[model samples]
Target chain A: MSEATEQNGKHFPEKQLWGREGFRDDPYIEAESLEVAGDAPAVILPLAAWLGLDDDVRRTSNRRIGVFVAPGESIDPLLDKLDTVPLIALQFPAFNDGRSYSKAEILKGRHGFKGELRAVGDVLVDQVVFMLRAGFDTLEVTNPVALKRLSASDLRDTPGYYQPGRGSAKTAGGFSWRRTPAA
Target chain B: MYRYDEFDHAFVAARVEQFKDQVERRLSGELTEDQFKPLRLMNGVYLQLHAYMLRVAVPYGTLSGRQMRKLGHIARTYDRGYGHFTTRQNIQYNWPALADIPKILDELAEVEMHAMQTSGNCIRNVTADHFSGVAADEVADPRPFAEILRQWSSLHPEFSYLPRKFKIAVTGAEHDRAAIQTHDIGLHLKKNEAGELGFAVYVGGGQGRTPMVAKKIRDFLPAEDLLSYTTAIVRVYNLHGRRDNKYKARIKILVHETGVEELTRQIEAEWQALKESDLKLPQGDIDAIMTYFRPPVLPERPEGWGALAAAKKADAGFAAWVDQNVTPHKNPDYGVVTISLKPIGGIPGDASAEQMELVADIAEKYSQDEIRVSHEQNLVLPHVALADLHAVYELLLADGLATANAGLITDIIACPGLDYCALANARSIPVAQRISERFGAAERQAEIGELKIKISGCINACGHHHVGHIGILGVEKKGEELYQITLGGSADEITTVGEITGRGFSSEEVVDAIEKIVDTYLGLRTSKEENFLAAYRRVGAAPFKEALYGPVSRAA
Candidate 1:
C-alpha cells in the first residue's frame, strides 16, 4: 500500500503487525481489520464505529444488523458522527442479530459516505454477498476463510442483477440507475 | 387493489433480469456467498432453516386470480407443493432450491410481481387494511397512498439502509385491521371539517423486544405532503437512529431517547427542506393513482341473504363461522369473507398448489377476481355478494381453506419463529398449535367470542403479541422456555399496548393461564358485546391476573 495518503494523524492506531514478522518486528500497521488483507498490513477498528465510510454518506439498512443495540439509541446518529473516516468495520456481535444488515446499508445508502465498508465479526459465507449488497465494500472475512471456494456472485449467469455500491462494480446491465448518463 | 401499469411492469421485469444476472454470477463462482447474500435478499430470497425461502410481495396483500394460479404453479414446481403466507401479508415458498430462485422470480415478474426488498433491511412490502377501500367504516381507501408509498420507496436511491429493516402500514378504516400501531410508520387517513385529506401519522411503533404503540407525530399531515413527509421521517431516522447497537437501532429507540416531540421537530425541520422538492404528491398523480383502486362495481342485491342468515343462525357450526369469519362491507347487500389461512392441524398461512388454484378459481367466479391477504393471515374476498356467501364458504371448505376461526381464539398470528427463521429465539408455531387445539372446539371458541391471541416465539413480536387482546411472548428463562402474558391490548383505532400482569408461566402452564384469562373475561363481562378487550379494560388486569396466578401468586 502507498504511504502517500498516510498522514501523521492519531485517529486510528499506527502499529502494523505482520504475520510472518511478528508484532515485535514490523510495527507500522496499528490496527488490524478482517478486510485488512495479509498480516501486519491490515487495520482494525472497534466493530461498532465501522459504519462510516470515505465516499458518500449512506446510513440505512433493510434487514437486521445482528448486533446488540441498547435502549435509548439508534444506529444512524453514531454514523452521523462518523464524518470523515474512510473505512468503517462492523461487528456481528451474534449471528442471530439482523441489525447489522441495516448498518451496512446505511453506510452505503443513508449516509452516502463512500469509503471502504467492511464486515468483520461473525461474517459467514452465508451473509457475504448480502453484506456486499447492503453496501459493505470490503469483508474482513475470518476463520480460515477459503480463498478457493466458489464466490457466491460467480454463480450468477447474468452479472448485473442490481448495482451494488461498496464491494461490487461489475454487472451485465451495469446498474439501472447509477449509470454514467449515456454520454 | 393497485394494478400494475406499464411502469410497474417495466420495473418488475428489470428487477427480474437483475436477479437472473445475480443468480448467474453466483453459479459461475464470480461472487462469494458473502457477496451474493444481500443481492438475493433485496430480491426477497432467504436461506432459511431447511432451505432457501423465496418470499414474493403481494403488495398490500392484493392479488388477482391469475396471480394466485401462478403462485400455485410455482409451488407445485419449485417447492413442496405449498407456500406460507407471512404476517407481513406476503407468501413464502419454504423449499425452493437456490438454483431455481431465478426461475421463481421470473415467474413472479410475469404476473406483475417480484420479491424486491421482501427480506432485506429495505422498505418491505407496504401493507394496509385487508378491507381497504370497501370497509364500511373507511373514510378513504388507504391503498392509493400505500401504492404511492410503494412506488416511491421502491428501489429508492437514498434511505436504502439504516440500523434495521423498516415496515409501514396504512389504514383508512376506523377499525384497525392493519395493525398500524405495531409498524415503523403507520398512516391513518383522516378528514377534517374542511374535507382536506390529512393523515394522523404514528412513528416508532414496532413489535420486537421493546414493544410500544407508535406515538402520533402528526395529527394532520396534509394530502400533498405524504411523500415528502415520509421522506423527512425516514431521513430523520436515517440520520439520527442508532448505529452503535442493533437492538436500539429502530426509530422507536430514537423516539424513546430524544423523545417523540424532538423526533417530530427534527422531522419537521427535514420536511421543511424536502416538502418543496419533487417528492410532493401532485394532484394529477394522486387522482391517477386512486383511479386504479376504485371499488369494484357492485351488483344489486338479491333477497336470499336474510334466509341464509336465518339458516346460519339455526346451524351452530355455520353460524359460528359466519359470525367470526365474515366482515361488513361498504355496500349493504355485500359482505367481505375472510378465508382463514390457519386451518386446524395445518400450518398457519400454508396453502398448497391445489389450494391456491382452487382459491384463484373461486376468487374469479365469486369475488370479481380480487383477493386480499390480510395482516391477520386470512384471505379476503372483499366484494363478495352477501347472497354468494354460502357458495364461497362451501368452495373454501372443499379446499380446507375454510377454517371457521376468523376472530375466534384459533385465528392467531404466529411468526415462523425458530422452525424456519434464523432470527427467532423460540418456536412459535407449536405454541400456536397447542393453543389452537386447547381452544379448537367450535362451540367453545364461539363462546369465547372475538378475541385476538397473538404469540411471538421471541421478542421480535412478529406474532404481534403486543397488540393481541391477550398477548403471549415466549422467552427463554434460565435455559427453559417460559411464556410471558400481557392483557388488554388492542390493535384497533383506539390502540393500546398490552400490559404485563405479573410473573410468566411455563410452556405447559401458559395455555391454561390464557384459558383462565378467558374464563375471567367471560365471567366478568357485562354482555356478549363486552368482548375480551372491553371486559379487561372495564375491570383492569387484576381479575385476569388473579385467575391465572391464583390467590397467593397475585399478592406476590
Candidate 2:
C-alpha cells in the first residue's frame, strides 16, 4: 500500500510506481523479468524487456504495464503492440533536455497511443502546460516546488495559445480575426 | 504594421504577470538562483557583469513611432538614459536593477512589446529583411511569415528547453540584405516556375566558435508548408541534437556531424507525417495574415526627384548624406533612409533617450509612422518620400544622427565586450571606437567605399565578426588583451567565413596594423570603385598578410 503526501498545499495519493527489483536504483538499467502475477501492481520495464516478454506473460498480466523510453530510441517496432501497454513513461534526463517532448508528440499524435502517457523525471512547473499540450496525462514531477505550483490550476488558466495543438484545451488557435469582418 | 489583437495582448499580459510572480518568488527565497536563471532568461533578463541587462524584441525589426517613444521612455526611466540596439535587431537596456525589471516589463507590455524568447534556447525573435515591405527588389513581404513564425515559436512547449539556442531568419529579396546564410534556418521567399510564392529553405548555418553557412535543404517549399516543414526540422533536431556537449548542441553541429543527406532524410520523414495536420497553413489564413502587412497608403509625387536633385545641388553635406544613406524604394517617390547609430568615435549601436525621441518624431513626420532596426546596428526610416530627404537629413543633422557612412568603413558593428558582458574574454567597444576614429574622415570613408568592420569580444560572435569583410576578434593572451584580425568574410548573397591572418597584436598596436592593412588594400585595389572587400576577394589574404606581418619566408 502507498501513502499520499501534500505538495504545494494539495494532497495527491501516490500512484503505483514499479520497476525491476534488482535494478530499480539504476534508473537507466533494463529489467530481467516480467514475473508479476495476474493481479499484480503496476510495473515499469525497459523497452527491450517489455518487447522480449513472452506473449502469455504480457497477455495474462492483469496489472498496468509501463515502459521507459529515452531519447534517440525508436518506437517503430513497438507501435503494433501498443495496446498491450497501459503506460508509456518518457524520461527527461534533465529539465532542459527536451528530446522527450517530440517523443511524446509522436507517440500520441502520430502513433495514436491511447494509454496513460506520463512524463517521468525532471518535470517542473514551467513545463507542465507544455507537457499537457504534448499529450502527457500524468507528470511524475521530481521537484517538490514544481509539484506545489502544479496545484494552483496554472495549466487551466493559461491565457491563449498561438499554435494549433492537440490533447489540451486552448482558448484560440484559428484565424477568427479576419473572419469576423473587423467589427 | 501588425497590431496586437486581443488574444495577443492577453497573452503578453499573462506572460508579464507570470514573470512578475517568478521574480517575487525569487526575491522571497522560494526559488534558487539556478532555478530563477532560466525563468529570468526566458523573459530576456541577463545578469551581466555590471547589472541586469534586459533585451526587448523588436519583432522583425519593425516598430511604430509610438513604440520607439516607449523604448526611449524605458531607457530614460528604468535604465541609464541609453539603450544598445543589438545585432539581432533587438534593443537592450544595460543597467536595470532586478527589482525594477517587472515594472520595466509592465511598461513594455503596455507598448505591445515583450522580451520573451529573446535570450532563451527557444526559437529566438524571427528576423527578416529590414527593408521588407519597401524594398524594390522584394518578391513578397517576409514580415508576415516572420510574424507567423514568431507566434508559433513563442512559448513552444516542446522546443523551449532544447539543448541550445536556435535562430531563424527570412529574406524576401534576391539581393539578400538579411544575411540569411548566417542564420540557423534561412528562408528565402521566391516564386516558382508556375509563379507561385514559396521559400527556398536553408538549414544548419550559424556563427559561434565554429562558423558554418547554411546549406539549401529544399529548393522550393510551397508557402503553405512552411510551419509543417519548420516544425519537422526542429523536432528532428530536438530528438537527435547532441546533449552531452553544450558546444556541439546547435543544429549546425548536428548537420555537420551527421551528414546533411541523412539529416535531410530524417526531417523529410518527420514532415511526411505532419504535413496534413493543423500545422499546415491554409491558403485563406495566409491571405488573412498578408492583409495585415499590406502597404500603407502614400500618394506618389512626380516632382519628388526634381526637388531632391535641387536640394542636393544646394548642399554638399546633405548631398553626401543623401547619396550614402538613402536607398531606392518600390514606390519611386519614396526612399529608405538609414540613420547611422555609429557616430565618429562613439559607441556602435548605443542611442540616448533624446536621440531615440528625435528619431521617433522624424519617423512619424516623414516616414509614414514606421521605423526599422537593422541587424547592422543602424535604424531605418523605410518609407520616406524623396522630396523629404533633405528635410529628414536636416532633422538628423541637428540631432547628430546624420552620419554619411551607412555601409562604409566608419559604420562598424561592435558588441558590448568586457564592459558589460560577463562572458567576454577581452574588450571590444574600445577597439571598435578606435577603428571608427581612425576611419572617421568623411572624404577618406567615401573613397574607401562599402566596407564592413565587425568586432567581437569572444568566440560567442555576438558582433558577427566571423562574417565581416574585416573581422576583429579580441582574445586575452597572458592577461593582456590582443586583437586578432581575420580577412575576407562576407555575409551577402555569397557568404564566406573570414580566415585569421597570423598572430594577434597588442591593443595598442592593433589599430596601427588595421591601418597598414587598409593602406595595402588602397594601394593594390584595381580601381577606386573596387572596394576593400572586392580587392581582398580578387587578390586573397596573401597580400593583406604580407602587409601586416612582413613577407612570409619559404625557407621554413
Candidate 3:
C-alpha cells in the first residue's frame, strides 16, 4: 500500500514517466490500500496483493490491473495470469543491481508477455539503452541528467548490437558479426 | 589480424562520439563522480593511485605493425613514454588526463581499436594463444573463433552489467598455451570423430582471493552453437548470480554454491531456448572471419638455415637466444619468436615507447608485419623465418629486447603492485627486479630450467600467482609487507592452483627463501630434465616446506 514515488526517495512525478508514445498522462495509479482493491479505474498493485485477489475479481474486474515486481521476486506465480495483466513494472532499486533485467527478459522472451514492460526507480541515462534492449518498453526516469537526455532524444548507442533482443527482427537481422543495419 | 570493415568503423565511431558526450557532461557537472565512474570504466579508464590508467584492447593478442606504431604514438603523446602489457593481452597506459581520454579514444579508433568493455562488469577482451595460427601443434586456428566472441561480447546489453567481470579464453592446441583452464570459460578447439571442428568447453575457472580450476561442462560443442551456448551460460549467471556480496558475485562462486551439476543443468536449460534462435552462428560468418586470419603467404627462406647455424657458431649469445626464445612453427622455414620484455633487473611487462617502435619496425621488416602480446608479459613475432633470425636478433639486441629468458627462471610475471596500483598492499616490480637480478646468470638459469615465479601485490591475483610454478602473494601484515609463497602451481594443460608454503617472509627474506627452494629442488630433482613444477609435483611440498621451516619436531 506504499505510495509509488521513486524508490530511492527521489521525487519524480507521474509526468516524468515516458513510453513509446512519449510523455503522456499516466492512467494507472498504485493502489494505496490493498485491503480491498479500491475504486481506481486502473490500479497497479504489489505482486502479492494482485495475486491475493479473488479469482473472480481478478478475472472479471472491469478495472485494468498491473503488477509491480521487486528485484529477486520470482515471476513464476504470474506465468498463468500474464494474459490478464496489462502491465508489469520491474524495479531497479539500484542502477547497478541488474536482477530486474533478467526478470524483464524472462517476462518478454521466456513467457512471451505482450503487455507493456516498464522500468521504474533509479533509472539513469547510461542504463536506458540496456533497459530498452532488455525488453523494457517504458521507463520512469528520476535523474535530472537522464531526464534532460531523454527529452532531447540524446540516447547515444551504436548502430548495431551484438546480441538479439525482443523485437530484434524489425531492428536487426542475421548474426551479430554480419548484422544488417537497423531499419 | 582482423581488419575493421565499414560497419566496425561506424560502431567504434559511434562509441567514440558517445564517450565524448559523456565526458562533456561530466566536465559540465551534469553528472556526479559516482554516475561517471561506470561510464568511464566501460571505456577502459580507471582512477588509479595517482592518475587515470587507460587499458586498450588488443583483441586475441593479434596486432599489425601499424597498430603497434599507433600504440607507441599513444604512449609517447599521452602517457609517460611507456606502457604496460597486461596478462589479459592488453596494453595499459598508467597516466592519462581525464579530459584528454576522448581524444585518445578517437586516435585508437583510427587504428581499428578502442577500449570498450576492457573494464567494467562486462565481458573483457577475449585472449587466445599468442602463436595461434603458426603453432605447429595447433589443431586449427583459434583467432577466428576468438574474434567471433569479441564481436558478440562487445556491447552486449544483457551482459554489460553482470554480477562481476567475465573472461573467456580459447586455445586450438593440445598444449593449452592460452591457459584455458584458468579462464571463466575456456574453449579448446578440436576436431570430432567425423573431423568437424568443435570445442571442449570448461566453465567457472578463475584466480582471485579464491582460485579454482574450471570444470568441464561439455565434452564437445559444435562451432555453430558457440554463441548460443555462451549466451545461455552468461544469461543463467546474470539472472541467478549473487548480488548481495561483490566477492561472491563471479560465475565461479555461483558454480561453487550451486554445484557444477545443477549449474550445468541450468545452463543447458537456458541454452535450449537460445540454441535455435538468431544466436546460432552462421557458417558463412565464421568462414568470413577465418578469411581475415589466414596465415600470410611466406616464401621459402631455406638459405637462412645455413646462415643461422653460422651465426650461432660465431656468437654464443645468439646461439643461447635462438635455443631459448625460438619455437617451432607450422611452416618448417618459419620460427615463432618470443621477444622477451623482462631484462635483467628491469621491470616486468613494461616497454618503453622507443622499444615499442623498434619492435614494430622489426615485426614489419621480418615478421610479416604481425605482432602478438603474450599473457606472460612478452611480445611475439609468430611468423619469423629462420633466415631472418640473425637480423631480428641483432635489431632486438641493440634495443635490449633480446633477453634470452623465454621460459627460464628469470622470465617472471609480476603485477604493478604498490608502485602504481591503488589496490596493491606491497610492491611487486621491485621484488621481480631483485629475483631477476639474483638469477641473472645465463648459465645458472639454464641449469635450473623452466621456473615461473608470478607475484601479485594483493589477493586479486592479477599476476596469475595462483598458477605460477612458484607463486608469491604480497600482503600487509601489521605495519610491514609480508610475502607468502606457494609451490607446484601451473597454468598449462594440467592446471593446478599452487599451495601456500607455511608462513610469509619479509621483503628482505623473500628472495633468499626463493633461492632456498630452488637449491632444494636442484638437490632432490630426479634429473636435470625435470623442471621445477614436475619436480615439485613429484616430491610434493614436503621438501620445500622442510627446507624453509625445518623438519617436523618429533617431540610434538
Candidate 4:
C-alpha cells in the first residue's frame, strides 16, 4: 500500500522518486505516459537523464515527466522541456543551501511554469515557509515533525509578509501594505 | 526608531512563539545539535566557549530611552549585570542559558527588538551611520532606508539560507563613518544633479580571511528601486555563488571569480525582471518609513559659549572631556556626545547595567531620548544641546561612563577574543586593557591625536582589524598565543587595508611593540597636528619597522 500526500485538494501517491525509474502503472493516463516511454507510464528522471533524452522524444511525450534539480545546478537545459513535464522537483541537498528557492522562483515567475513545483531532500519544518513562498506547492519531507507541521491548518499564521507574490494579502508571498503615521 | 505597527507587532510576537517551540524541541532532544545550530544562529544564539551568548540587534544603532532601559533590565535579570556592544552595532549578553533564550527574545520583543537575523546565513542587522539624522554633512538620513531593509530582510523567506552570511551597510555622509565599503552590499544615499534621491550601489566588499573593497555596480540607482535592486543582487548570488568551500562561499569570492562586469550584467537582468514586481517600493511607502527617522525639530537656543567656557575653565577634567567626547551637530546649538565605553584598564565596549541605565537617563533628559551605538564600540547621544554638555558629563562621570577618549589612542576596539569566542586563538580584551592603561593619561592621548587600534582574536575579522589605523590580529602559533600587527588601515572615505609588520609578537611583547610603533610615529610627525595615520602614510612603514624590529634590514 502506498501513502498519499495532499496537493491542490487532491491526494497523489508520491511513487515518483528522482531516479531513472520505470513509469507508474496507471490505467487512466496510459496514452499520456506511453508517448515517450512507449507503454511505461509516469516515469521520473533525474536531471542528467532528462537532459539526455532526445529533443524529439521529449517534445512528443504526452506523459507528464518529473526532473530533479540540485542546488547550484543550472536549469537552463531543462527550460525547453518544462512545458512537457508536469513536475519539477528541486533538491535541497542540504537545508542550508538555498539555491532551490531561486530555482523555484525562476521556474514559476520567469519561465511561467504552471507545473507542480516540489521540494525534495532535507525538507524541514522551518524551510516549508520559504518553499511555499518560492512557489513550491508540493513537498517531500521525511521528517515526521515537518510533515505534521505542514498538514496543520495554522502553518500560515505568521503575520504580514515582506515579499509580494502571486496573490494579495494573506496568501503566499503577499506583503502587508500598512502605512505609518507622519513622523 | 521605527515604531512597530500592528503588523510589526504580530510578526515579532509570532516569531517569539515559533522560537519558543524550537527551543522546546531542542531541549526535548527532538532536534539534534546539527539540526538546531542554524535555527539558533538565525535567532542570534551562539554557543560560545563558556556559555551561550545572545546578540540582540539594535537596528541602525538607534534606540529609544525605554529600549536602552530594557537592555539594562535584561542584563541585570538574565546574564551577568553587563552587556558588550559589538562592532556590528549590536549587543551581546555573554552568559545566557539555552533555556533562557526564548524568554530573552520575548523580553526583546516587548521593545520592538529581537535577535532575529543577527547571525546565521541571512541578511544580518542593517547598520548605518551612527550620526545619521544629525550629521553635519549628510545628503539624507540613512536610517529610514536601513529600517526599510530591516523589515524586508527580517524573516525573508527566500534569502534566509544563503551560502554564507550577508551584511549590508548604508551611509548618508561623505565621511563613511559606517564603514560601508567593507560590507557585502554598501548603499550610499545621495542626491543627483537634479537633487533627487538615489543610492550609489556597491556590491561584494567584505572583510574576513580575505578582504576586498566593494565596487560601485551602479553609480546612481533610483530610490524607488532599492528593494528590487537588492533582491536582484541577492538572487543572483544565491543561484551562482560557490558552495563547495565554506571559506570561499562569500559573495566577494563570487564577485572576484565571475568578474564584476558579468555579475553586474546578471544582476541588471534580474533587476529588470523584478522592476515591475511588487518588490518595487512605492513613493508612499518610502515617505511613510522616512517620516519615522526625521530629526526632532528644536527651536533656536542661546549659544551659551560663555557659560560653557566658564565651566571648562573651572574644571580641567570637564574641559578634556568636552574636547574629546563632543562632536558638532548639524544644528549649531546642538552637540553629539560620545560616551566612551573604553575606560582605563577596562574591557572595551562592556557596559554594566548601572552604566546603561545612567546613559539612558541622560539621553532622556538632554538628548531628545535618542541614543546611537557606533561601529567603533561606543554609544552616542546625537542630539545633546551644547549647553547641557556639562550636566551630561557630570552624570556620566558619576556612573563611570565618562572616559573622555572617544577617538583617542586609548579608545581601542577589541573583540571578545579567546575570553568568550570559540574561534579566537588569543585573548583581545587583556591586550586592549593593557594598551588603554599604558596610554590612559588624558595628556598622552591628546598628544597621540585620533589614533585607532583595533584587535581581532582571529582572522574572521570580527574586530574590524582590516580597516583599523593600527590593526592587531591574534593567531595561535605552536599552541601559544601570538599577535600580528598591521599599520595604516582606515575605514573612512579613503578605505585601505592595513599592512602586516615583519613578525608576530608574543602576548607579553605585543603591548611593548605597540608602544614602540607609537613612539616612532610621535618622533617622525612634523607637528602635533599630523595624527598617527597621516604621519604613517607620509613616512611609510620604514621608521615603524625599524623601531619595532631594530633596523629595516633586520626587520625583514
Model 1 over residues B483-520: C-alpha lDDT tens digits? 88888788877888899878888888888888888888
Put down candidate 2 lDDT per residue, B333-406, tens digits, no spaces.
99999999999998999999999999999999999999999999999999999989988998999988999999
Output the number of the TM-score-best candidate.
3
The interface root-mean-square deviations, each candidate in sequence, come to 8.4, 2.6, 3.4, 2.3
* Ten contiguous residues minimizing lDDT sum, candidate 2 chain A: A18-27
Q: Write the per-residue lDDT of candidate 1 for residues A1-183, one digit (tens) a residue.
A: 111113322132332211211112322232323245244333433334334332332234221122222222355556654544545545454333445555565556656766555554445444444556666655543323222222322322223333333444453332232222121
Candidate 1 recovers what fraction of true contacts?
0.00
What value does the lDDT take at residue A152 in candidate 4? 59
Q: Which is superior by lDDT, 3 or 4?
A: 3
Residue B85 of model 3 has an lDDT of: 94
Error of 2 at B205 (Å): 0.5
DockQ per model, Cα:
0.05, 0.45, 0.52, 0.48
- Candidates in descending DockQ order: 3, 4, 2, 1
Q: lDDT per prediction?
A: 0.73, 0.85, 0.89, 0.84
- As a TM-score, model 1 comes out at 0.77
Which prediction has the highest DockQ against the true structure? 3
C-alpha TM-score for every candidate: 0.77, 0.94, 0.97, 0.94
- Itemize residue pairs with steric clashes in candidate 3: B304-B387
How far out, in Å, is residue B241 in model 2?
0.5
Rank the candidate models, highest lDDT first. Answer: 3, 2, 4, 1
Pick by TM-score: 1 or 3, better one? 3
Candidates 1 and 2 compared: the better one by lDDT is 2
DockQ of 4: 0.48
